[model samples]
Target: MFVGCHVSIRNGYLGAAKTAFAIGANSFQYFPKNPRSMGVKAFDAKDAEACRRFAQERGLVSIGHTSYPTNLAVDEEDMRERTVKHLRNDLEIAEACGSLGVVVHFGHAKGGEPLEGYKRMIRLLDELLHDWRGEAKILLENNAGQGSRMGTTIEELVQVRSLLAAPDRVGFCLDTCHAFASGLWRGSNWKEVAAHMRSSGYFSSLAAVHLNDSVYPSGSFRDRHAPVGRGEIGLEAFSEFLQTPELAEVPIILETPAPAIGGHREEILLVRKLADRQEGVFDLEK
Candidate 1:
């Protein structure tokens, strides 16, 4: 299994990989710029090349994520434009940094009609994909069902994927915290979730998993992410994810709270250990 965590980009675009390696991770994710800012930093070819080389030498897989504040489902024209522009930049950065894929959030619908909002999102994604020049695929992350967020359900994500012009190039990332908050499944019900995904043809498109523990009770609609095993999702829920045949090879990335330098080491080790055990069966009584 490819296991890792989200690392900071303060060092450099390539510095994320180094941080991942220091924590004994073989894969990782990072944003290209300040996650809360709209300003784009000019890409440096030299840094990109060095980061790409480092990943190649170590056989590490890299993933890029869009900033949290940008929303594709907003009614404001200026915000929508800014959202598209930044997402485009994110793809460019992902390509430059040799990332395999980039993960994005389906924007909240505000007071708008849900179906109409979904259609708008589809049109935006189509436009983006048509103009996309990068090789890295884009993966839409599941949300925590807060307010009027779209793509909180797997069905919604499936619909979005089906309507995209390049369905093969587009994919999905399941955030454990979001899933728990949405009441889709808890850690104990992973096997059932996997079965549903497989039968629904969504399993093949699974490119990444956000491995986070939740800070709220089940179905609380909270987005607070605690470190692995420290919150409601607990440690055992991860084992079910690791043992699932369909998800065994996908990259599992931790977005849990932790210190930048040495924060993710223990969690990374724990996930790796769980993956190695390959607990194929989930006994509910245990």
Candidate 2:
């Protein structure tokens, strides 16, 4: 199973891969640029190629995450242009580093209609992908239902994809915390969630899974993430969710809170153990 957590790219792409290896991870996610700022650091092509080779040699999966400031649903022309520019840069970096794709948040609607926001997002994305020739895709992430955020529901996400000019170049990244917080899943019945995703055609486009536990109760609409098995979502729910047949081959990325890399390592081991239980390969009690 491909499982890992978010790692820093401060050292470089190869450095990030090494960090994942140190933590017993076969996959990892990273921000292509400063997540809180608009500034992007230039990367050495040699280092990027080396990182790709290293990851390929070790069977590692690396996924890029777009900066948090990008808002595809923005009404302001300049801001929308800047968001597209940043996304283009991110895609370039991801392609260089041999990443699966970049995960993006469906930005907020604020004073605008949600449908309009969805259309705006689609239009902006069409502009972004129009002339771009890159192997990395754009993976939209589900929101936690906070305020006017788009993509809070699987149906809405599916609709957005249907409207996109290049639906084949765009996909999805599912976050367990967002699913619980948005009331899409109540920490029960993985089969039901899987069934819904299958019927909505979301399963076919699924690219990755953000394996997080929610810090708050279901339907809270909060985006707080907690370490696996240590929050409201609980361990039992996670174990069952890990065993879902549809998700078996999907890369699982941990966005859970961690004090340090060591904490992430522990969580990675725990997740592996949970997944292994399906084959009676490990006992949690031990």
**TM-score of each predicted structure versus truth:** 0.92, 0.95
Residue-level error in angstroms, candidate 2, position 138: 0.5
Query: Clash number for every model?
Result: 0, 0
Candidate 1 regions with alpha-carbon error over 4 angstroms: 259-261, 278-286
Q: lDDT tens string, model 1, 56-134?
A: 9998888988887876676777777777777888888888899887898876787857887787787777777886767
Q: Itemize residue pairs with steric clashes in candidate 2.
A: none
Query: Residue 5 lDDT in model 2?
Result: 93
Model 1: lowest-lDDT 10 consecutive positions: 277-286
Which one wins on lDDT?
A: 2
Per-residue lDDT, model 2, residue 243, is: 83
Candidate 2 lDDT over 41-101, as tens digits, reads 6768888888889999999999999988777798889888888888888888899989989
How much RMSD separates candidate 2 from the native structure?
2.1
